[model samples]
Target: MNDFWQQCSTLLEQELPSQQYQTWIKPLSLLEFDIEASTLHIAAPNRFKLDWVKSQFSSRIADLARDFCCKPMVVHFVLDPKVARRANGATMAGSVDSASVQLAAAADLTAQITSLNSTTSETSIGQQKNSAAAGSGWSGSPLTNHESSGAPERSKLNPVLTFENFVTGKANQLARAAAIQVADNPAVSYNPLFLYGGVGLGKTHLIHAIGNQLRQQKVGARIRYIHAEQYVSDVVKAYQRKAFDEFKRYYHSLDLLLIDDIQFFSGKSRTQEEFFYAFEALVANKAQVIITSDTYPKEISGIDDRLISRFDSGLTVAVEPPELEMRVAILLRKAHSEGVDLSEDVAFFVAKHLRSNVRELEGALRKILAYAKFHGREITIELTKEALKDLLTVQNRQISVDNIQKTVADRYGIKIADMYSKKRPADIARARQIAMYLAKELTQKSLPEIGELFGGRDHTTVLHAVRKIADVRSKDALLNRELHVLEQTLKG
Candidate 1:
């Protein structure tokens, strides 16, 4: 099992970039392995890395284990330093402190020992301070596979959503300040910070920035951040496997808990019970608990009253949808990260049209850039308009039946006549129905117009065709891709 872990580490080193390996992978120690139980025990430097690896890379590691050792593997992550030291007793002897370990050779046996034994004392205080300073500017780190037993899977939080990237607008300014204060002095300003916002607002980013700051300040600090959906899923999994005690123990031990999308637990009674206990445990211990939800605590219907009251105990902050200027700033920042040079005009145009969300703004930019690169065109107003025409049209206008028939027939190498012909063939029917649905989407033409276009069929017939095509498209990836391409072609 140790050899397998070493091999897994080598593979991870090859897979992740050097910088990411240094930040996230270097701090992990393989504490124990249970080959008979197919479990691998791992010690994470902090809870954030532990959640990240479990969320993003556990399955990848499991697949690797199967490939390398012909055995199934489960990862058990222990964030406790004492547990790690005890489990890897032989490996920890004579290991230098983590600060003294060289970057390239940090995975050496000596370094592992040092990492397991390092403490939050005066001798390590300077290193912790430096790490905290580094984290304030750090973006994100890569994930690694450590062993754990049936632990809840982890989710990846974007590293770039740090304090630096978060633009301080009037809407989120107070929340930003409060979050900063909390990060600077955890469990001091807001014991249970409640941040609520619509999608793509900076709630998750702010929470992560706080966690990053805390980890940097105190390397031994325990921070556990997860999506509420994950908490619910863990509850379900625990109930199924009768491991409820372990589940509670896992969350109750956290020094800080950041739960995203807390609204997801609104109606889940059992999960809410588990979460309530976890919430109270952390709060009682004076651990910082930050939560993000789509709606305010009062507005989130179906949540237990006790849970809602607990959520409202701390300072409540809301991140409003970004205004025009803020949107432009976000675009500029995103463009900078992507190494794309965006003129003020281009950024303004994108921000004006893609006001749906920040993610949409970035997606539009990516699409436009991709289209420009693919066609060897300069990034200009005309190019941007053309590149985004399809998406914009779908967002604003409907497609006609004639348009759908024409687009589908052209794409499938079949004639429009063949679509209406008495051929009950599989391919022809599929094409004909797709044409009917496209007409429904691309044009203002009525269902009768669509039906008449396809062999004088009835409006109801067009409706049925549309429904059938939609059902097929949902399950068929190739069909979905083809439809997307057709949409792009028509709109562009």
Candidate 2:
């Protein structure tokens, strides 16, 4: 059965690009080879991937089986958790497993956090009160009121997400530096170092890095890293359990607090109110706080103004999409970590096409690695191209100047015509400027070409719009978020 599946995959790899072959066909297994019945049962990781393979590559798989068996064959696909788990267990050297593993571990950690916070002895409250009066500057390792042992508490942070291994680029350098300062100095440097960006730009990773850093520096510190959603769940549970005091006590006593995706508190008034109190308690005691969101503090619409103001009171940083060189460097470094010496040419090829975020880049790299490993082929630029053909086609189609204009205009609630119109209303004109900037960023079109697309304007007009938006985005968080959304939409 293994030999039969190998033959089928080999044929598919030769026929399809690396990404398609690896993503759809490689995870499949020969569940059953019914020679007498002229049927072959195949297994896919999950229903979604199986459905994709069934719709897109089932016929080819059937044909391959028939060619190998010298008869007409029917291929059946099934979802098997056992098979999926086995496939996802593949690890990068010393790195965390696949996304599923990460999610499962995160859930377990969240449970531990809730349990630990609610179950602490009431006797620990005096310790926190005494410590609060000592000063919050995270200098030498200060003992927590609750922590009697000289051992570190389980911070529930991903140890792999450390600052040492984090890839730095202009996009994330500011956030990374602030995280470092907060981690090194704790409460004194940036009380609540807030990080914001589009999804997958490493906000979560940065916060976890801070927690991990502090956990190492202050072994006796009470450190907690949690998603805002988990924090909300904790609040709800505390309310139901009538254990708000313990909750408040546990949170307020922390030497450091790391919260990811603070935007999740939207419309959850109770959660916001609870978190505000905790924020005040921690900051007032000189404890460190770090937060992350998908946008700037002022842009998170349903969160309380007071919470937003607190978030802004500390340093706020943005992590933009990686530039071309940075993306290539990341690919190379990640490949090296996996013990694969990928060439710069191949890295460039993959980086040129995957411009949205690091996760997207990692996904493409995984596909390429899987395809190359499955087929025992050497990595090359042409191979990278073949592996990412589907993604390349979609990105090329989506990042066109016309698509950018349409996406930007639609997002701003303006008509598509307004993108090229001569209208100079504040909103419409701003939308036009954004479209022009995107056209320059996403496409290979020259300045003159972009200008021509924008109602036959001059190249200097396009360049000026590009320069102005580029300059303003660094200082204006709202506009920066808008551009990030437009870029993500265009890339997708």
Root-mean-square deviation of candidate 2:
18.1
Each model's lDDT: 0.66, 0.73
True-structure RMSD, every candidate? 27.3, 18.1
- Each candidate's number of clashing pairs is 22, 2
Q: Which whole-number lDDT from 0 to 100 does residue 140 have in model 2?
A: 48
Q: What is the C-alpha lDDT profile of model 2 across 1-492, one tens digit per residue?
A: 778888777887786533335445665677899888999888775544565567556666877888889999988888765745643222333222222232233334334533443345224434543453366634344434433222223347799998767776556766776676566556656668888888888888888888888778666667788888889888887777677776777788777888889889999998899999999988887888888888778878898998988998988888898765467667877887888866544665677677888999999999999988888887766677788889888877766888788788788899998877898999998889988988877876767778889999977688678868877987787788778767766655
lDDT of 1 by residue, 95-114 (tens): 22221232223224323333
TM-score of every model versus the real structure: 0.51, 0.65
* Model 1 regions lying over 4 Å from their true place: 1-150, 153-157, 394-492
| TM accuracy, model 1 | 0.51
Model 2 residue 206 CA deviation (Å) reads 1.4
